[model samples]
Target: MNKKVILSTVLFLSACGGSDSGDGISLNKVKSNDKAKCSNSRLDSCYYDINQLALNIMFRKNDTGVLNVTASVSGPKQDIYFTGSDVLEIHADGEVFLPTNNGADSLRYENIPDNAQIYEFFWYRNSQLVEYNSIDGITEPSVILSTSQHDGSNTITTDWLNNPDYTYQIHTPSLWCTNLNYESEMFSPSTGILDNQRPPYQATLQALYGKNIESLKVNYRSCDISVTLIAKNNQVNYRNKQKRLFIHHDNFSEHPLTLFESN
Candidate 1:
């Protein structure tokens, strides 16, 4: 198998809810139902039923005259989660724009007209948007929603060992094996395989408390791999930190191993 494909598969399996077993719910359908409920209501409701499944929903009125709506479902080994805080402004003509804060440094806008309001949303493994409804009038969210397969178990085991202050673990896998060729060069590269350059090491990161992982980069040199994780708090200040680990292998070894943060 190709190295990138292999790494992608390995990371996909290691993260939660990649199993073939029938234990997860279809979050796309759930989001569709949730959006339908939002449109059907004069005011937002907390919970809604979709295909006989109950989902927790929330909405906030932002400063932009748009309603920020979020919907999520929680359970053990199985959960349906969806979130989009972009402004849902009802224009004087009743149109909407799901204006997204592009990056911490930039902003992008998606206009949602009134004709097409129904949307099907989905968030699959690696925070990838697997599927969604491209309705004529509904603008999609800027940030991708988090989703998991639900197996009827509502209990979720979170990582509280590293930081007890938070109850969940952020799932960010370092992509050193895929991106950096420490064995080939002593200097760190700036790009990755997906960027049309020598693959830079990469990692998938998950944030806690509904936080989105942002601004990630890797530093490599002299058989050393360093991962930097950053997240925005309260839509303003940034929480930044770095994870440093050493990579070494014997000349005869077939697979290289990395040791960092006790992992």
Candidate 2:
């Protein structure tokens, strides 16, 4: 697949809401956390303060593989999604085949690290090696492989080039900060005392797809905030949930507290 084409498709989806389902499966709401107390008299009542949202996918292949995806408010107006995928595989004598071709190549058996399991082969358009993880073992043109931490957690680590010019490396870690600022402006009232004090926020992106990703969707107040980036990870995992809170003081008067993502 063309990298630019894939990136563009993901970005377009992030910007515009689509059919909400792909690859012959429909997405079902798994969980949500929404809590914003505003009476009918409040101007912000039109918006819903979101706490948390998550989606879980279970493949029909077997009970051993699953994907857990979560999204949370990072600032007054911003939200971030984190996802993780778990897969189980078969290895012969603790050795697995690592393929070099983009699905057309042959797999060569090698002694992989105890912590590493042959998953799939990652390739650039030219078929250069990018990374491999366990999920790739099941994907077409399986060139990428994935290895997990072996702690029974979904955390998997793979080799990714850190070159500055690499598109995926440029936007990560910084996009979280940039998103916080962008969201503050969007959620602030255009005219009011609260306008001057936009709520503060922050966000983090986790990769569930094994490689870096580019598009994400955040939900706030029944509205979805689409985030398109120069680069991002395929999924994100957090030791702790990303949280944001907003405080407004108008002419020496303080408004009640507002939480970004409720527990």
lDDT of 2 by residue, 1-263 (tens): 11111122221121132223322222222222222322222112112222322212111111223211111213232332221111112222233223222121111222322222222221111111111112211211111122212222222222322323222211111122114225522332122211111112112224322212222223321111221112221222121122221111101111111112212
Residue-pair clashes per candidate, as listed?
A: 21, 27
Candidate 1 residue-wise lDDT, 17-45, digit = tens: 33221213222222222342234331222
Candidate 1 off by > 4 Å: 1-95, 98-226, 235-263
TM-score of each: 0.17, 0.14
For model 2, the superposed segments whose C-alpha errors exceed 4 Å read 1-117, 120-184, 187-263
Measured with C-alpha atoms, the lDDT of residue 189 in candidate 2 is 18
Each prediction's Cα lDDT score?
Answer: 0.24, 0.21
Which RMSD values do the candidates have, in order?
23.5, 24.8
lDDT score of model 2? 0.21
